[model samples]
Target: MVSPQVTNLAIILVMMQVSKQVPFDNPDVLLGVRALYILSNLIILGIYLYIQGKINKKRDMTTLKYVEPAPVGSGEEPRPVTTTVMEYDKQQLRQLIKTQMMGVGMMGVMHLYFKYTNPLLIQSIIPLKSALEGNLVKIHLFGKPAVGDLQRPFKAPQGLFGMGQGAVKSDKASVENAEKNWRGGVKEE
Candidate 1:
């Protein structure tokens, strides 16, 4: 299967092509697309809120331990991360929410401030699609087991053009090493 990044790119390109055909200069059409954009944002927000509720209900408190990979070319040792599933899930949700907010802010600037209307239509569809395909949505909303790709500390997202590596170091030995190093006063950088 194609990666989500690739799929998202394809969708954006297709939408851009479609957007060109839209009569944004026309007042009625622009109004309709703006309404659609608002509706889409609300729907995604509702889905995230529902998933948040589900996560709170489950309250999975299982201990989750892993070694967080150091930043690229930082010459730093990976740091050991220890957190409960509930905490981890909440952090992930916060990240998602933050991302959604940023996107909305950007769209607002483009559509409302800059008077650019093409993105209003494209943004509407892409975000909803992304929310539905999100890892949390798959696990909590769709009831997929948290294994494989859906596993905790999800493999760091592959970088653009696949140049960036995840190297999360979640294996038992790596985790232990990181923990020992952390406790031994080994400076991270």
Candidate 2:
């Protein structure tokens, strides 16, 4: 449930500490590893885009509309309103794909730079980046359930040894509610 910014910051701090402790001077190994990472990311990105294309094709062939309840005044009765929603228009889909491609490109650049400067830093960030990309692909292309536990802001750990029971309980409840409403829950007027 850690925020991405916080997680990134922690990764950088750990990388700095580890780099100081274990200095790596082998450029050949770093380059090899960086190349492998970039190749793997590109492969995954290609697959994600392919799947998204298929999904968008299917969506574009369909016309979807739904009825939503209109807001009612204190003394009025609720009325249902029909709304037409283009879930995956061609332009929007293209834009989404472009954005994801840009993200992958940026990740590749950052990772390669970090690998050369501080080899240890790239290790921590790679898994985080992969998980984020996987989540993005899942939600957009595969229609898979998201990890609802991360929707809320993280509470500072509080207790003896920083293992707080109150925070755990609240976090658990919030996660449950989030899971229940994961797929754009029903709107109440």
Candidate 3:
């Protein structure tokens, strides 16, 4: 499977080529792109809202435990997390919404403040696409069985180059080690 970074790069490249074909200098065309951007953001937000509704309705309360790896180069030990499936999914969904909002805010700055039109057109589609492709949507929205990679306490996403292990550790030894370290002040290597 192609990495998400590669897929995103390909999408951006194609969008850039398409952007070059559009006449951003034309006020009418620019207005249309701006409208498209707003509409796409609204659609993405609507999808997330729908997923939020689903999560609220189902409210799976299965307990989940994992060790969240510490930040790279921070010299901090991994921390244990204990949460219900419902809560974990909520946190995941909240993060997705937060990231989308941040992107929209930055894009608003770039397009409105910087008066950049091409990115408005390009970004108009990216978030919507991401929202549709997101794992939470696959499980909650599309009703895919959350087994394997979609399992609860979903594995941390691989880095762009697949350079590191997943940050969330569910294995018994890892969780026990993190719990011990957290409770007993054991220094993590």
Using TM-score as the measure, which candidate wins? 3
The global C-alpha lDDT for each of the candidates, from Candidate 1 onward, is: 0.88, 0.47, 0.87
TM-scores of all candidate predictions against the true structure: 0.92, 0.42, 0.93
* Count of backbone clashes, every candidate in sequence: 0, 0, 0
Candidate 1, run of 10 with poorest lDDT: 180-189
**Position 83, candidate 2: lDDT:** 22
Pairs in steric clash, model 3: none
Instruction: State which candidate has the highest lDDT.
Output: 1
Candidate 3: list runs displaced more than 4 Å: 164-166, 183-189
TM-score of 2: 0.42
Clashes of 3: 0
Worst 10 residues of 2 by lDDT: 77-86
Q: Cα-based RMSD of the predictions, in order?
A: 2.2, 11.7, 2.0
Ranking the candidates on lDDT from highest down gives 1, 3, 2
| lDDT tens per residue, model 3, 84-129 | 9889889999999899989999998998899888999779877887
lDDT string for model 1 (113-133, tens) is 898988888899889998988
